[model samples]
Target chain A: MTMNRETLINSILGLALVAVPLIALGMDEPFIITLATKVAIFAMAGVGLNLVLGYGGLVSFGHAAFFGIGGYAAGILASHALNYEPIMTWPFEVEGTTQMIVIWIVALVASALIALAIGAITLRTSGVYFIMITLAFAQMIYYFAISWPAYGGEDGLSIYVRNGFPGLNTLDPISFFALCAVMLGLAMAFSAVLIRSRFGLALQGARQNSQRMTAVGIAPFRIRLVAFVISAMITALAGALYADLNRFVSPTMMSWHMSGEIMVFVILGGVGRLFGPLAGAGLYIILEHLLGSSFEYWQLPLGVLLLIVVLFARGGLVGVLAGERKHA
Target chain B: MFTLFLEQLLNGLQSGVMLFLMASGLTLVFGVMGLINLAHGSLYMVGAFACAAVAAWTGSFWLGLVASLMAAAIAGALVEILIIRRLYNRDHLDQVLATFALILIFSEGTRWIFGSFPLFLSVPEFLTGTVMMPGEFQYPLFRLAIIIAGFVVAVGLFLLIGKTRLGIRIRAGEADRGMIAALGVDIDRLYTIVFALGAALAGLAGAFVGTTQSVQVGMGEPVLILAFVVIVIGGIGSIKGALIGSLLVGFTDTMGRFLLPHAFATFLDPASATAIGSALASMLIYIVMALVLFLRPSGLFGTEA
Candidate 1:
């Protein structure tokens, strides 16, 4: 309960994330506001990944599956709503809605179900096999998305208008940014609470020593699977937000590169740190903006920077700023 | 119908052979060094680029092939010494990220050097035309040559691993790193060699396939993923597994794409059937992988986890 350097840093980061966007809005710089929204959405996805990867010790390399699922869910629903068509008419009737809340719910449920199936199979293997399997599964989905032309296939689907939110102009950059930032805050708070709960303790325990946990009568598999599902839901939520932010959805969301970038956010911010994803996402977006505008081959420098972080700066930005975690 | 099936079968075998060329190196590295090199794909790209550049400059595909092997092997050795050596003891996540960074570097570096436009590598004149098969069916001679070349390399790898002192050291290194080090074997040199060997194989595959497809940046990724699928299906770290797994995947994928739409057209409307069939066909290998994992998590020939 004592105030700590990391907590202070986290507080500053959260506030700055919102304050900058607000300042951008006041200055009529909507692009900066949009960029900040991207940071928030990417950070939220990173947070989702951190739960299983950092806390549960399950390194999933295919989280983009859930992310794309969320994106496509939003895109499909919005497209159907715009076209005045039913999403499903078999067994019963299902209508598409432009409601943000409905899209979010659908995204979460769909991601959870898919994650459960994926995790049930992938979680059976550990180490390299797990990583490869997760990656392959995501690629499978990516290929499916590219070939399945109903929702635009390789071209992608774009929503003509941003989906509705009650009493708010969802089309306004500032309004959308605020919504994304708020959702990010909620996700961080939820993760913070979940990590400190008894279930969180058990999850960490399993991660540290599954054999020891088994000896103490705890089943690691179920706990990890639950964490994995929860992680997918959070990321899926971010994906939906991201799709709305761009007003478009595509298979690029589910590419292995996206998964790697998500992992980079967690690593760049310092894995397991509460605000690591925010810090990482902020730095990454800023670097992308700055380097991208100035250099033709910006990704070259980005890659070098990433290599430096992995080789020398193991703790990432948070680790550099606040020092290493006491327990770890 | 039979001729079409025969042609598809040959296509599957050819692609399967190329998959083996990639997978063997990947599985070897994972087995021997306990490392997964995502940049293995970059090395493939390196080979393709190297071959294309050399072939274009010299006007000879043969010399370009040689350049590809040397270029890729050199790149592999440098990367092993500079980056991969440090990663041997780190957890998988660190390795994954570092290699992912390497991908970015390699991809961008290639683009910087070659520009964004794809370079083409043509098959040598000797291997250019189609040949008569049983039932008077014609197949691309280049593809048939790829299958033959792949088998030749597979045999070469088997003999190298089974007969040579270096192979003994590699197998030993896989079994116990500590033991090999204690025995005064130059472990660093050995690792560098294995990594380069794997890289060379990947490069060779890239060079070969480069002729059939456009030689371009980012080409190695899909093959890399397919190789991963092959290794996973055949069981990680098993060469025999990589071969069998590669063929299984190759056959399954090629046949699925070829046959699925027609099969589905039996019931569904042609347009819808083609759409559904191709989508499912693309996903078939992963489904096979899932089923394999569901039944045998360690893979067919993998050591029990």
Candidate 2:
């Protein structure tokens, strides 16, 4: 694996430009700011998924569960704060924190806990069973969200104001965008570091050959489960940010379609690439914006495009431009 | 309480049969072709559309049913030839992505042709009423007919898979793909037949369901999940498992919804009971599946793979 210095330098330069939108505050371009924010939020989610699907060799079709859980955490917390309701009462009166940092922490913990339970069970099986079980669990959460009417249920809940940040007005577009961009960068950096770490190496190795990993004295199950939980936590945090950005959260976030779209981003960006999520999220949103504006049947064209990509192109967009699938 | 329980049980049986119709084809295809087809739901949607369209045009429910089966089978075979056949040696992810692409194409194509509005079909006049049971409870006769039809198909499938020359070929294909092909069997044609057969079953389920509810785009997805649950619970490649698994899931899901709320109401407030019960009821099937996998990872009827 020879590293190309020029290409690496160019990638860094390109990524630096991604931050240029944060500086466009004087222009008052809400549209560009919002779009960039959306791209960042989605890319963060994609990075989370790539860890499990690409690095851990586990394709969880139930990621929407974690994503939705994150959103619900933020939404439910905000609603509780707004209404002066105790979130859950016992020895402690749980109340929503208006701070973005605190909300993200709750989201991360909630998602990680659920993932831990789900992964513990799902990791016991392999192949199709694993896929179906994850899907079933996701559907369970989706149905529960729909039926539970306390916090708006199927109608979804809306946050009146964006969650706060210490020194910045979060309602301001630039501040919010910066928050999301920082989180996205952090998630991406986390992924890169994990892939280079010993656990990351073991996870990748398990994906390549579980039998050989076991023969080499590593338990593939434990390694994959840890990676899956971390992956879910990252996605969950992104979900919280996404809901804050929209000021709304609903069961739709938990829907299987959301799960599918998350996987699509990872595949579209070139599965294992560190920047692939950012690339894929950018392309997806751009296509959605463009094709949505141009024609009514945008999904049809997008579907056709995806088919061609799967059939003819082995690697995703990154593969097309950067060559073969990059090794972790 | 007893009457409501009976009604729910009957509902479960009806849903189970519909699931079996869809799952049988999927299990057979997987057993023989070693392909994981995500486009099976598309075929189901196609069938429902064909049934609804033809029923509306000709004003004949029977004709509509036949058209649905034929259209779905033909569509399935065409898909097998054009796309699925090429995917025989591909990895599961590739298969998933390709079929996922097909889903988008098929769903968008259907919406383009039919528009986004849902199409409705009426249950035939003969099966529209309710049948009185021995316990003085009445249930929808149409649902009962579905159960009967499912059993008939199950028996027919059993005879076909276990007692016929085609069955032998299918089993041979499953057991030894290379050896069977070496013996000059047209494996490609067999795969096409299996794929078509699965599509036809999905069509039948869709047609039946369309009569009860409006046929619409994305209608096949929920049923697709149930079908997946059936195959997973039954064992991926086992027809018998699909049948049993569907029944267990259907019964458990229905009964959980029916009974759990009542049980929770005994202790908790009615409002909380409803929310908590519904949430727990929804998780019941998955919990059962997790338990099953824990006890027998290969599923009840699945062979050690």
Candidate 3:
């Protein structure tokens, strides 16, 4: 809200995240562009999850369901388009489209619907029940995707070619990276706007004391459900973009591991903070790339690092570096 | 057809019993301590690995089982003291995140020690035979033993929780942590003991399961997810809920897999039926859970969410 030291740092961090990819493109380092794309994608997912996790105080462990749903939506659409078949051949025929904008919409709508259904049920319970139920739902979807042979099943599906954007050569890594950065920027701005809105205030209030919010005529349950759905939509959108970036989609993208990683990004960045996801995702990718090159068992050290953060650094990397900034 | 159904039913019961063993520990820990240990699965993995290693070394299934119990107990105690105690007061998200980190650490550390390849534990020679059930069905002796072991553990837990002084303290602690602490109960030691007890049960479950399935890294995760479903369907902190929920889920999952193809074959071609059936079958338990929670939000026997 205010341009304080932390705010300045957050802006710089966000800029650096974008500028680094641009520099890599100028230097013709495709690998760095790919990595930056990954950082932006993961951060976007984290930003989405943070809506409910940090702001709404509703920990939906099943966010992977939405992410995976997003991936499958894109994968399925592209596969059907490649095959020249209608995705749905019931009362009406619906052909798949390889258009990025269309894919984003489909992914967003599909994930939002799934999220709505899951949120409606899971939102009834709070605390640990919410967490586990969300997980169970995600696992259910994962297994379903695995068992259903109609669209690649456990083997996963791939687009014959990278889906196209309006005017950009989507195959070029830099162009793709720019597309992801733009999405992240837009998502970040959307989140910032949502945070400043009345609904966001109510959600935060509900997080702190739902009973008090209720006493003040605010329905915490409704606030939480809306926030949950919106979070899932954002994550699902990220999932679609991620699938595009990789040119493949699989059930692994929807697995609990993805959900956990998404949470880790948000936590590692700084929960409830706008730039936190960006910072966290950036740090995680850099650490992963560095450590993965050196050791086969990088997760052990990463786990230890995460443990230290949870124990000692309660605020995370962004929180530690930027002392309690109000907003992005 | 009747024999086939009966065999599938027995299989369901066997796996249900295994689920019971796993879910019991989770429910007990939740009920007694209010801590959600995602690393509970890692402890199961530890038990399996310990049993596998010990059995390979000593060539004694009994000794291996004992080692699994001890390894899991010690690991549980250390986890309790080193990390879980601090998380008791934190929010559920922090606990989830912390335990999740423990999972990564434990999983990788185990992988470092055991290597990534799966280890197999053989059933002891004595229990390798099949036993005849009523109406001429043959069931694996080892699986039947798992069911019996599950029954034994269930009864033991019932007695321990229903009659023991420790159980009273646990109940008191659950009812009010501050009151129990004020009453001069050694809360720390009690927590460690309870956590260890839960971990031992999980270890035993793992050891029993390892003979049938390979002792692989990440093996506990799928089972852990199912156990979580069991507890959620049963209620977060209710053993009775866990037991009933496990049986219901086990039967539903097992039967759905066995019968869904046949059921779908009536309406669709066999190939697609098999695919659709299995797809729907895999989702049946979660559907049941959602329905159960919808009807009874606190679970059938759970006192609270």
Candidate 4:
């Protein structure tokens, strides 16, 4: 792909997302920092979903299960650590963890495992079947979370104090924001690399033609299963950070509404485009801020804008500004 | 023990019928239009809200029910003409997103008109009492009525889609839209009617269900989720698949909810038992779906694509 006006716009968007947050920090605008933190976390979740939704041609409506799983990982671990309880006792007695790195690893692994199970079953069917099956799995987890009261049940789990990174003062908004930004940056880089990798090609090939991909000796199922697992892992990381940001994790985090929001970010930015999630997340937050402040019923107008975008802007905001969907 | 089991069976049948009401229209729309409508639930919600509002005004449950059907069918038609028609050619992602947007609009729109609090609709007086079975089993008359209504509609729909010219047109349209259009069937109008018909069915479900559960803004969503599960398990395009699937789901869910906690209670502490039992019970239908998909990638009645 040759660089053009779209590429330029993409670069500006990537830089703007990171720079604006830093600027907000420098200017001591705590609210902006918090908002930027939200943007980064949501964008990260979108990037995770983009792997399967855009590149692999999977439209999962149940990504919130992974997100919620990641969230509960953090909340459960932190709670257990605070209250001095072992997480798992019979299988070698695993204790609770308060460290961010440990929490993220646990979140990633737990989410990947769940994704593997869900993806294995769901990948059998394509189109609407794929969509609904994934949704069913997510709802399974959502209902479980709501009913299982060990942590909090209908009322979500809350962290009394922020879980700590190795050296950072997480209590400070800027520090937490910086941590989230770094993870978001790493995930974005991973997305760029994965899309251009041979595995990425195989995944896209399977999406385009299962027959040809099969003839070429690539098992589309295996490729998608791996991609789906990885996608869930990344989204799970974002879920952990989001829970930390709010210092609370609830069934709401895993609700279908949350899954929709994550999808909206990817679509709004530009599916399959580098930095689309970032741009989408930023734009969505900006819209929320603008419309929310002015109107009592902002969701109505937001819905209208979304309809207009889907109807007219096939590529999305990133697509509109950058370019239409082109061959990768 | 027999009566208890019988009551669970009846409960399952009652909900199964309501689910069939929701699933038939959804399957019909999906089978024919190849459209995955997320806002189908919103139409259901619309039916309930309209029924409740009108019933309160008219002070008659029967009137409310009619109002629900009219309001839902009209809303469905308008949505089809205005929004869904343009979406026929787009990818599934676009359809999902656009309909998802409709959900937000419809939800907030309803909230805008009616407050956040739920509205109640009483079952009509004549249907309020319970009927005694042969030996000490008493079944609620209203539930039995809903079951009867659901079966009547099922029979009516089967005949409508099988015995009539319009049904043939719909079947032909499902098989090949282009071929039907070439035969001078006015495909666009047919599509609109099919969509409205599906919406009317969903509206009927919402109205029927509203009499039992409170009418609220987001109430249609969980039912929508269940309906989706039913269609998938039954196969997306088959009405027979939908009926069987709904019954299976309804039975499994009701039985699981009723029996699982007791099974767990015999072993674990009541607190943990209830929690874990409820969790597993809620997940039981999905487990059933996964198993079904494992055996048949396309549902039991679904044609393999």
Candidate 5:
């Protein structure tokens, strides 16, 4: 395949993301590997959001709900498994599993279902209402997480051991980073394919002009709803990985700030750019690490940077690197 | 039992009034500017911090209140001119991001100045005591003051919007920004004024509530979310909707916490009942919001989009 400028840049970014961890492993810098893993996981969540926000034009301010649900899914199941407790004991008994595959499946299904319900209601409203309703629903879940004591509530739940992968020593930071990086790669590939598909065109068309799309005999609502659910599932998967990386899950993961940060990853990278989230997340984590060590008030600089980006830099890092997207 | 209910009801009204203050400004900003200011809460924090600082230095609550209003309005106007003015034509996504960035800046800046500790503002000496109710029950005089203040603002807002010349310009601007500008209304100045007005109301709320709650860096956020719920339920651009929605949310939230656990205790064990009750109560307002939106997507009083 011929490599265009954007594609070449994306390839370099993808390679560098993996190369950083490998180099860190060679140098035995485990903390660097872990930070890279966080970037990968966060980038994956941003990828999920980019599908909806970038492509579909649905500004869901509640993607954290899926991410948190994913984290909790891992946390809850692992806790129950360690304690030898059944998650449910009634009509049909279900026990928790410390298996990573099981955890991912649970996270995906739960997030998809919740997204469907939330999308069904929130999709009815467009523009500002859509943004606010999505936020309100996420807040609902955040409060529920805080108040519900079943799985530790506001204190959060922790996994004593990393959930097992079939063949990997998940305890090692490099192995975990590889696992997360691989997942992020797969999510990006999937997003690229999805956006290139016929369904993707429909979704984009709806975003640009829903009325016109409707005239062309497509229901924008269903397309948006589907995109919303798919977007959530991917983010939820990231949340599961994040939980394993930290060995913890807390309501903080579901907070509005988390949602804002995830959105920032997309915006800082360049909305609609396939690799935007990864670029944005990588930049953000690096800034946090560098500035956090030096300045006590790192967020002040971060906020100023973001404001400048919004005011002046219409496109994000990828936009600066790759130039404006050529409309086909 | 009756007294307890009445007390909770009054508590609900007090909080509802606080929410109304926040929501009125938010709705007005959205209505007039068509901009969603996520950093409006930051202005509230500015107000609280301003009030706390002034009151602590001068030992005068009334003076602090005035300081809060001025501080928040000035901050709001500055933000509008410097940043928000540019975002008027951008998509909501851009506005949300810019404002979200503002939140980060405002919060971290305040933290740098105030340190990480919370500040306290004492209610003035005369308003510190409790007032007697009809059933010989007593309520905090400060809380009663908040409710009264909220109503006064509400009435004042109605008259200002309904009876005044500035209100006419604002309403006209909301209805047709281009048309008003074409007719020589100085739309930019009008937007700045509307934004400052909203910020002042939010500041007033922060100052009043600061006396009851600790003035802290992050206090505005939770209140901001609650205020968002109020405006969402009431309708985005409607002050009347905000007032009604604020009362509903406040009453439902306070009463749900007060009543649900007892209602559950009748059937379940005390511990579990309290746990489940509080959990549900916390989520009760969001559920109400969803229901309201289901029935009326624009909100209770919002114009159909």
Candidate 6:
């Protein structure tokens, strides 16, 4: 008569997803809607990272490369549209669109292509080498972005208006939150589906034992590369939303700190868990809001808390709240 | 061209020595304990801060240097006992996270202590002037002193690792941790000493640097990345490799920036030349790394396959 963990979790998550927005609606609180929207976007980024880091076992320190690329994709496109210039032209004219559908797809594709290139070079090494190489590559990109004067460089590009959605006015706070929620839901669904698929199983297998996966007739490189690309795409989607949220995008988004923070979010949420990123993001935002509001030097306290978590609380917020699942 | 080459060579050697100081401790810690302490840089920062603060208070650079090394070593030992001991069996990701958290704590802590204002330390009077060389060129005595100091440390470390009884235990532990454990060596104590020694070396590098430039918060980060690059280019666990790799990186990085802009200026406009050259200069070492990896994936002198 007892329900299984999977079904119970699915039901609870499903309910919470619906309940959170509804609760915000009932409260009629703009602040709650804004908070929920931030959580949704960050969760999307976490889900993206979980694909490569959690499943593929690729500890890519350069993921912010994709995240920043995605933001720039959105920024450059919109700026081009605003200024009536093409992003890149061939025989056919290219134009930017405000529609989330076009924006998201373009961002995803741009990031994936870049990820493919970076992953190809970096995936050659394993272990600490991989971590540092990816980090170096990411720093290279960050520096390039900082030095390049076009598109605002270090100061960054700002969006004057929220990119449009066909049926909704994105300038409205709740409506914007709804847009992020829908994207987050879709990203979560995509991740769940991807992990359950044959490719996902193989990717997980590669992480567990790459030699065994190869012995079974799978090239771990190709599988990991694909997973890395998909992971980057998802993070890129979040980056687009994040830029839109702040109405600005800069080299800081591409910074090594941002990359570190993204990795921190994944680990804090419980690395392979479905709802972990959401939980982690929610916890992080709340901590930042509360601690940041309370003191001039709140980062000192936050650093201590993170140290405690890393040292003592290995499973993170989601793992503590739920329970540990075997590292997939 | 000869004068330019000589200047770059001296610059390269100076840069190499600074890197050697940082990389030696990093490689030693990695070789012995098999721990990647990203926070080795923080100890460097600590040394710089100590040097700057003490020199300012006491007005003796000599006293400041001594304080820097001792403070850094003590801090390193404490961190090792308190936090890093717990991380020995944990995943590398976990170690990285914990150390990264330490960096945040240390950086903010220093900022709090130092008030974000960069502190300056004047060079000692004895090392203040330039030494004349052939072809009417001159090099700063302090930079030359740094190179000599680094060479002295290198020789001392070689002696320490090769000659001392503790060095034997460290070597034995690196070769086979289980056998050393079975031999009843205090592995934990060995690890603590190794970590502290590495921290001391890092601290020395910082103290030396502080005398040359203003000591500031977050100064260790860029140097940390470069140190990582050095070890990767050198074999991860080889001290000799760290020295060679440091020279290679230091030369390439400095020379690339100097020569590339001039080379590019011949073909392109000044603005474009500056942009492209600086970018390429920054990327040169990483490019060298990629090439090295292509030929030997383990690195130039790495023991691992």
Query: Cα deviation in Å at residue B256, candidate 4?
Result: 0.7
Error of 5 at A70 (Å): 0.2
Which pairs of residues collide in model 1? Answer: none
Report the CA-based lDDT of candidate 2 relative to the real structure: 0.86
lDDT tens digits by residue: candidate 3, A112-188 = 88888988999998778889999999999999999999888898999778899999999999889889999999999
Residue pairs with backbone overlap in model 3 = none
Q: Report, in order, each candidate's fnat.
A: 0.81, 0.56, 0.75, 0.75, 0.82, 0.38
Name the candidate, 2 or 4, with the larger lDDT value.
Answer: 4
Listed per model in order, the count of residue pairs whose N, CA or C atoms clash below 3 Å is 0, 0, 0, 0, 0, 0
Each prediction's whole-model lDDT (CA): 0.94, 0.86, 0.90, 0.92, 0.94, 0.83
Every model's DockQ: 0.86, 0.66, 0.83, 0.82, 0.88, 0.56
Model 1: per-residue Cα lDDT over A1-328, one tens digit each = 2239888898899889989988998899999999999999999999999999999888899999899999999999999999999989999989888999999999999999999999999999998999999999999999999999899999999988999999899998999998999999999999999999988999999989999999999899999999999999999999999999999999999999999999999999988888999999999999999999999999999999999999999888998889878866
**TM-score, cand. 5 vs. native:** 0.99
Judge candidate 2 at residue B156 and give its lDDT.
93
Interface RMSD of 3: 0.8
TM-scores, each model vs. reference: 0.99, 0.96, 0.98, 0.98, 0.99, 0.94
What TM-score between 0 and 1 does chain B of candidate 1 receive? 0.99
C-alpha positional error of residue B136 in candidate 3 after TM-score superposition, expressed in Å: 0.8
For candidate 5 chain A, the 10 contiguous residues with the lowest summed lDDT are A1-10
Poorest lDDT segment (10 consecutive residues) of candidate 2 chain A: A1-10
At residue B199, give the lDDT of candidate 2: 97
Higher-ranked by lDDT: 3 or 4? 4
lDDT of 5 at B256: 99
lDDT of 6 at B304: 75
